[model samples]
Target chain A: MRAVFWKELADYFGSWRFIIIFAVICLAALSATYTAAQTIRGDIAQTPTEYVFLRLFTTSGETLPSFIFFLSFFGPLIGIIFGFDVINSERSRGTLSRVLSQPLFRDSVINGKFLAGLTAIAIMLASIILVVSGLGLRMIGVAPAPGEVARIGVFFLISLLYVGFWLGLGILFSVLFRRTITSVLAAIAIWISLALFISMFAGIAANWVAPVDQHSEAEAILEHERIYDSVMRISPTTLFGEATETVLNPGKRTLRGVVLVREVEGMIPGPLALGQSLMLVWPHLVALIALILICFAVSYVRFMREEIRAT
Target chain B: MAPPVVETIKLTKDYDGTRAVDSLDLRIEEGEIFGFLGPNGAGKTTTILMLLGLTEPTLGVAKVCGHDATREPLKVKRITGYLPENVGFYEDLTARENLRYITRLNRIPERQASGKIDEVLEIVGLSEVADREVGRFSRGMKRRLGMADVLVKDPRLVFLDEPTAGIDPDGASQILDFIVSMSKEKGITVLLSSHLLHQVQKICDRVGIIVKGCMVAEGPVERLGREVVGGGQNALEVQVTESSANLIESIESIPGVKAVECSGDMLSIRGDKDVRAEVSRAIFENGSLPLHIRAQDYTLEEIYLKYFREE
Candidate 1:
């Protein structure tokens, strides 16, 4: 397993695809950061600390501070590219048959690829985080508080897991599609529709789908809206973005003004509490892990049972 | 009385509704260079894939070095090294890196790997190009590197699918020579598959001719040649001074003459037994001056064409 892992890791760095991905992610994050910095200099300079935090969490601009939003939207795209051709390329090149003829088990090949991709993502994320954080500190002219540092660490972890979800999805598509181009195109289509288009149309979809007649009871209307939001959040990217926002800012209570209000008269939970935020997103986390495992399981079984001679 | 290095008992493989390999019964002896000769889609690759555990047989069993290929693929893989048609390596890495990676995956002892890598590189004539990136190498160079990778593990049995395909004649001859020497000097069993009849004929002691997923004929190259070209009997070509129609009739009427064809004054005769002396005596007795009489042996090309054209 270690041998396979090391070779895959070397392959990732040795290939031009990895370099291109790293450059794209870095350039995108830096562009977002620059825009955010310009906006911070222009508006609400004397706002209170809570209001400043809220603005940082809610707004998307061109400064390093706004990179979290760009990353959440763009990171999954990178993850998909990383894995969409992993197995298919090997098969096309005729290397899969040769590799399988060795003493290593098939499961190790899948596991090693996953670990290598994950490691590459971690490296990319860490470098982006380091560069952005350094620029942010320089611009703010103040060292980050320990709480702020902790929030950033949590955000990094969330991004890693978010990328993991997409990596698994791409690998599943790779196994299911015989052609590498088809697998990559399929992944891109899913990304464009779910990541970019779904959220943009969520409100309109909700409005069109929901019954807005005045005769309808408020409870019924609220129930209808809840279903719409749940369905939209089914996309792991959307769920992870919303969760990251809640974790990083800590005070934002609702995402897009669609909140699941649970009436609890006995005790009022603190809105900015980290533990509360984690609990709220626990289901998304579970779903992400489940999706990753399912994709991996499917890829493993298919590759093991697949006729290598077919390619 | 050593066990067969590889054996298949009525092995079969079906793809979708079509049978790719139908009840293939094969036994390859240890240290023998066996040729699997067939045209495209003749199940030669399929059979090799099944033996290497890259594909599952639909029915019956295949064993490599006494290990059941389906149920115990790892054991089979451990003893077999396979080079697929159009074999590919990590082009971005150096040839040495590619061999090193395969060697590691095959779990060659760490201490012995460096020496084995060097030895295999030298064996494949890639020692001078070891440090060059595989992407920059020519196709023939890449193929040699691939062979080195296969041999790095020192496997007992090797499956080579069109190992010399696409190579220059000089490179192909070098590879064939190496294959023959490996089997003879190291006692390695080799199963080489090829659509090119002459390539296999040059190196293999025994050849199995397959057509449309069926083994039509199999035997030592000389024996197969004899069987297909009429049992080792030579064909005699005679250019007589006089009109040869009478000579041809006389030759056909002579004992042991199988067939006779006459073109102008030239007569060609095929016989089941050596009849050169008898033909000369008959020609002399018929009062015809024999201008030229030459005996010719049947080439493998003739035998291959004869058998392949049968169905």
Candidate 2:
């Protein structure tokens, strides 16, 4: 497995495919961070001073979304790009049988690939985070508080899990399909539906489940929001979006329907502490982890049982 | 005698209700190059996969070096190497890097692996191109790399599935020579699967013919030829300058002639023994001139065709 892992890692870093995809991701991420930093600089006086650095990630400018939004939307693309050809290319190259014929267990092939992909994602994410932070520091002359730094760290981890889920899905497709084109097409289709078009789908589904009108009462409105939120959560994109929102913007109290005033009469109005914020998104984190494991497990089983033909 | 290097009893595999490999009983002794001869989809590759433990057998068992292929696959794989049909490498990495990965997977120490990689590359005549990215390599070069890949681990048994399928005659011969030398010098047991009959006959100590998931014949090439076409049988063709009833009759009357066929000025005689001497003398006795006389030997191609035609 170590052999496969190290080889795959070198291939990923050395290939033009990795360089191009990573460049696109970094350019988009930096631009979003630059725009957010500018927006934060202009409004520093009105924003909470302690969480000013956190706002560098959440504030959107006139033309671009926040840094977190860009990541949530593009993280899946990175994962899919890295994983969509993992097995099928080897199959087409006729190397899978050769590698499997060596002195290692069959599971080692899939396990090694998944671990290598995760490591690459970690490296990519870390670099982007470091560069973005550096840019933010230069533009906005405020260092992040310790609590804010911790939240950012947690956010990085969740993003990794989110991308890892997509990587697993890509590998699953690669294992199930014989041709690289077919596997890549399948993965991209799923990515389009879940990452790009899922919100549109969720809106339609949610409206059908809990319809509302202009004159609808507060109860109907709350029901509609509840249905919409749940439906959106079905996509890892939404899970990642909500999770990072809670971690990066400490003031986000809940991802649920609007609470009644009576229930919040004595509750604190300030941002939740890092631990409390984590508690709020715990379920989201679990769901992302579960998604990653499920994809890996299914792909592993299918690959282990697959008949590898030399041709 | 010592245990066979590869043993299979009643091994079988079914894909989607169609049996790809039927119950096959095969035993290959150490230091022998066993040719697995079959046409496309004749269960040759399927058998290799099952023996390598890449796929499970529907019935019976395969044992490699006394280890159960399905239950103790790692052990079986540890002692065996496979050069898959149309073998592939990481096109972006240098040849040495690709081999380095395999050595790591086999868990060879770094110092030893480097030496082994260089040694194998030299054996395959790829030392000069070791630093070249595999994407720039030709088909023949990739095939040679495949050979080096299998040899890097110094496996006790190697499975080569059509190692020279699409290479030029020169390259194919070179690969065949490599296989022969590896067996002779290293005492490595080889199970070579290919549809190319003459090539298999040239290097194999024994050959097995399979048709539609069943083993049709298995033995030394000469023995199989004798079994299929009959021992001591001769097929002789004689060409004459002039044809007449007298000449035909005289040739037919020759001792050992079983059947006589005449087309144009040629007579094809089937005999239980060589009668070229008597036939030539009789032609002269009949006052006819003999132009040419030739005897055809039954080769693996003929044996393979006989099996398929019978089926």
Candidate 3:
């Protein structure tokens, strides 16, 4: 298994696929950093701050999206490309049977691949985090507080899990389909539904479950929106989106329906502590982890049951 | 007495409704080049998969090197190497890199594996292209690499499924010679599968012909020919320009030659020894002026057609 891991890791790094995908990721990170840094600098000019590092990751200027926003949008592709051809391509190349004949357990192939993918994700994500932090320090002229640093670290881990869920899904498709193109297309199709269209689907389901009646009062509408939001969180894409928002943007007090209190109307706004932010998004984190596990489990079983000889 | 390298008892497999391998009872002796002969889709690959423990049989069991293939596949796999038909490598990695991955899976210590990798590559005559990416390799080169891949583990038994399927004749012969030498030098048993008759006849010490998942015949080439066609008899065809009714008596009178008969302008001689030169000399000296003399040896193809045509 260690052999498979090392070889797969080398293949991932040495291929043109990794070079192209890494280039896209770094460009996205740098552009997001530049835009967020511009906004944070303006904010600093208006009011000096200790959590400028966190603000740089969350803030988006008029012309560019934040780092979290870009990652939430394009991160799945990285995972998809990494895993879309992991198994089917082996079958096509006729290496699957030969590899299985080695002195290794059947599960070792999948285990090694998944571990290699996670390792690559960790390294890529860490590099992006460090690079963006550097840009923030140079642009904002302020270091992050210890609590804010902790929040960023959590944000990085959640991003890894979020991307890992897609990696597992891609591998599942690769095992399910005999053709590499079919697996890649399947991954892209699923990505489209979950990343781009799941909220629309959830809205449709929510409307079907509890329609607002149009003539209903604001209270009924609030109840309708509550179901819609929770329903949208069923998609891992949505879960990761909300989780990162809650972690990266400490000012995000809640993801649920908010109720205004007249007694605290004049109270000043302040960023939530790291622990509070974590508590708020704990469910999303768990859901992402569960998604990763379920995808890996199903793919592993399917692969083990499959006959290695190509028909 | 040492156990057979492979023993299968009533082994069967079904994909959906169609049985691929049905009640196959087989024994492959230790250190012999055993040929598993069958036409396309004749369950040769399915049997190989079962023996390697890459796929489970629907019924019965396969034991390889004393390990139950289904119950202890990892143990069987540890001692077996398989070169699948059209075996593939990581097209992007160098030949040495590809072998390195296999060594790692076998858990050969780094110091040992690196040296073993070079040794096997040299054995396969791939040492010159060790640093070249496999994508640029020819079909024949890839097959050689597959040989190197399987041999890197120093397995006690190697299963090569159509190793020369698409290779040129020279490459095919080279591989055939390599297989013969490996078994001769290291006493490594080989179970080679191919539909080609003459190829298997050249190197296989024993052969099993499978048709529609049934073992139709099994033994040495000569034994199978004798059992299926005639006992201790081979035919020679003599085409003469002049009809010679008296030539039959003259041919039979030669020692170890019998069953001489004349059909039209051709004389058929069935004999134990290949006395084509003497028969030609006899016909020439007898004034028949032999136009063409051909040996009618019963090859695996003729034997295969005789049995396969039955079902």
Q: Tell me, per candidate, how large a share of the native contacts it keeps.
A: 0.78, 0.88, 0.83
lDDT of 2 by residue, A182-238 (tens): 988898898888876877877897789888999988888888888888888899998
**What DockQ does candidate 1 score?**
0.61
Tell me the tens digit of each residue's lDDT in model 3 across A1-311. 78888878877787888888878889989998998888766656685465667877777889888888888877798899889899888988878877888878867888899889888888888998999899888887777778878888998999999889889998999999999999999999988987778778878877887787869766667677887888787777788878888887777787866454753488678988889889998888888888888998899789888878754
Off by over 4 Å in 2: A214-217, B231-297
Question: Against the unseen true structure, what C-alpha lDDT does each candidate score?
Answer: 0.80, 0.88, 0.86
Model 3: interface root-mean-square deviation in Å? 1.3
lDDT over C-alpha atoms for residue B93 of model 3? 79
Best by lDDT: 2
Candidate 1: interface RMSD equals 1.6
Output the lDDT of residue B17, model 2: 98
| DockQ (CA atoms), all models | 0.61, 0.68, 0.68
Model 1, residue B264: C-alpha shift (Å): 9.2
Q: Residue A221, candidate 3: how far off, in angstroms?
A: 3.2
DockQ winner between candidates 1 and 3 = 3
Give the lowest summed-lDDT range of ten residues in model 2 chain B.
B225-234
- Which residue pairs show collisions in model 2? none
How many residue pairs in model 2 have overlapping backbones?
0
Greater-lDDT candidate between 2 and 3: 2
By TM-score, the best candidate is 3
